[model samples]
Target: MKEIVIGENQAGQRFDKYLSKYLNEAPKSFLYKMLRKKNITLNGKKATGSEKLKEQDIVRLFLSEETIDKFSQVKVERSHGKLSILYEDKHIAAVNKPSGMLSQKASGSDVSLVEYLTGYLLESGQMKEEDFRCFHPGICNRLDRNTSGIVIAGKTLAGLQEMNEAFKLRSLKKEYLALVEGVVSSGAYLKGYLHKDEKCNKVVVEKEPFEGSVPIETEYRPLAGNQRVTLLNIHLVTGRSHQIRSHLASIGHPVIGDGKYGSKKSNQLFCDSYGVKSQLLHAYRLTMPELKGELNYLSHKVLTAPIPSDMKRVLEGEHIEESIHE
Candidate 1:
């Protein structure tokens, strides 16, 4: 048997939910049965999963040690390379993920940012396998494999839960910088519906809704440009797979170097000139609103990842500065 004292972060959460995180190997039906049989108790009394937790409340978990380890310990091959950290705190961390790295995983052997961050915590001794025996720290957001930017990771359960809520509600704002083909003289708000083709790993943008289509909103302001290309600051109001690339292509301004949605001639020109293979887009900036209670430390702050070298060269050749912020 093990006892846990609810802290501010754990306070106000449902009792059953807390137990599920602790004894994850056990099923919900088993947990409910345990509660009914007085095996798992709240403050030394029988309780239901719906009981609202409070600070100083005591929770007793009555599972064997082996069972707990089976559910909580997920062994990952620790990455040896260094990570570019943007921001970090006791509850959370934000890192600059490179363009080629997988946010999670693409295959069984693939190493991911999630696994790396977990390994980071363990290496730093901030957490251990035993600590994760209940809850594990992880990235709260994801970036496409080829798109690089600020990736926020949760170091604690409260941080993870709060970050999930923030993203789900779109309270957390993200901004990206991209180089698109053609000169966009002015800014515009673009709204459309999109349908994704899973097999081809592509999307079709439509002016109207369709059977599998989902509504999307994108806003952009031209930062700098020349006749052949425009550098942009993009705000993704609704994030979907390939939303930016397809939407811009639908408007005849596909992102440069994007072979999927962009012109083959343009792609060939860039490849021949600069060896630019991936789309010239980067999720380089982020902003957060005022947060209360446990996550208050991150309130009203901004995070940024420096532009990659390839994109920088493109902007430079166009005679544009590194960036423009408003």
Candidate 2:
């Protein structure tokens, strides 16, 4: 028999969901069997799988301890890849994930940024895959597979819950720098409806209403501009699939090297001349509330990754002038 005490982070989640974390190796049949046998109790009363847990709830399990031991003994492998750890503490860690790395494991591949971090934790004696119930390490927000930028991961379940809430409430702010073809007007607000086409693996931007289309708003400021290209500071008011790229393309200013929504001829010219493979978009800044209130005002962190060589070459070649706003 084992007693599991719920914390503030685990509260409000379904009983079955919570149990699934602890009983990692237990099959679905075994879980339902235990539930049917009334082997799981909450605060000394029989609990149902649908029951919602509350903070400080005492959950008692009559299942054999050997089951949990077997699950814990299973070792998950470490993924071989490069991950730059930006910031880390007992509760969470921030990483600068490079382009081409999947944020999490895909349908078949076990190697991903998250798996790599998990392996790092295990090697550091901080956690194991089975112990994820108590110390739930996970990525809070997602970035596109081809987009590179800062990624925040929670080291504990509480941290995950808090960060999730932060993102949900829009308390977290993310800023990006993009290099696009043609000169974009300063202080431009692009609003449109974005619809995803799974068949083509692309997103379509429509100025008018379309079936099953979601509204997307992107605010951009032209930081610098020249005859050929411009540097844009982008703010996402409404996050949608390929919102920035699609909207910019709709306005005839697709991001450089964005083959899906850009000028292929321009991309080819730039790639052939400068040798940059991916689009020129970088998440440069992130601001969020910290766990401690002392650093509340200073919670904003700016991350500046070097511009891809291809984009740099183009920008340097052009004689663009930076504009200062009054």
Candidate 3:
């Protein structure tokens, strides 16, 4: 027999949902069957799997160790990479994720930023290995594999839920810095419809809506530039796959080194000059909204990540530093 006590992370969710996460390999039908047979009980009584779990609630499972082991999938491999932390608190953390790091795993063996966060928490004695049974700290936002910048992580279940809600509501404002081809003389608020081609992993922005297309909004201001290139601060009003790159391209200002949506000749020029092989885009800033509860400390706060060395070199070479703010 196994007894699972609901903790902070495990509570506030449906019993069936919790069961699925705990016994990941077990089928929903099998879990329902076990519940019906009284093999799974809540607080010493048979449960219907529809009950809401609360902290300190006891869940008893009348099953053998072998059965439990066969159903649960628990694999923890600590990441060795050192994280560049921007800000951290008991509920959440913000880190500067460099280019070429995955926000989450693409495969079972892949190590991502989430793993690094886990490793950091463990080494700092902020978490225990056993604590992963119910909840694990993880990134709430993601950046492209080649794009570098700020990433937010939730250290506790409440933090995760609240942060996720804020992002979904678009309450948190996000900004990016991009070095692009051609000069942007002024700021503009651009709106368009976007259609994504999944097979090609690219998107097209159009002035008119197409079938299956979604509306997108992007705003940008020119920080500094010359005739050949420009540095711009981009405000991502509506986050979508490749929105910034594709939208800017539509305006004849494709981001340098963005092979997917940029000019090959321009990309080669920057590649040879700056050794920049990926999109020269960085998630620069995040402005917190009026938040409540545990995350209220971050309310109305603005977080920024410094310009990467590679991008900075290009700006310096272009002599645009005089017009840039900070």
> Which candidate number has the best TM-score?
3
Worst 10 residues of 2 by lDDT: 289-298
Q: Model 3: runs farther than 4 Å from truth?
A: 1-4, 25-48, 60-71, 107-109, 322-326
Cα lDDT of all candidates, in order? 0.84, 0.74, 0.89
Model 1 C-alpha lDDT per residue in residues 209-287, reported as the tens digit of each score: 9999999999999988888999999998888889999999999999998979999999888878877888888988889
How accurate locally is residue 203 in candidate 2, as Cα lDDT from 0 to 100?
Answer: 91
Error (Å) of candidate 1 at residue 144 is 1.1
lDDT of 3: 0.89
Off by more than 4 A, model 2: 1-17, 24-78, 133-135, 289-314, 317-326
lDDT by residue (tens digit), candidate 2, 1-326: 88878875578888888777677677767777778787878888776778898989998888677766865344454665556887777766778777678788766644678888887887788774556554447898777776777788877766677777776766667777788998776778778898999888799888887998998888888889877789888887776768888898999999988878899998997788777677877666667755343223336554444454555676676665433222
Off by over 4 Å in 1: 1-21, 26-78
Q: How accurate is candidate 1 locally (lDDT)?
A: 0.84
Q: Which candidate is the best by lDDT?
A: 3
What TM-score do all the candidates reach, one by one? 0.85, 0.78, 0.88
Better of 2 and 3 by lDDT: 3
Number of clashes recorded per candidate: 1, 0, 0
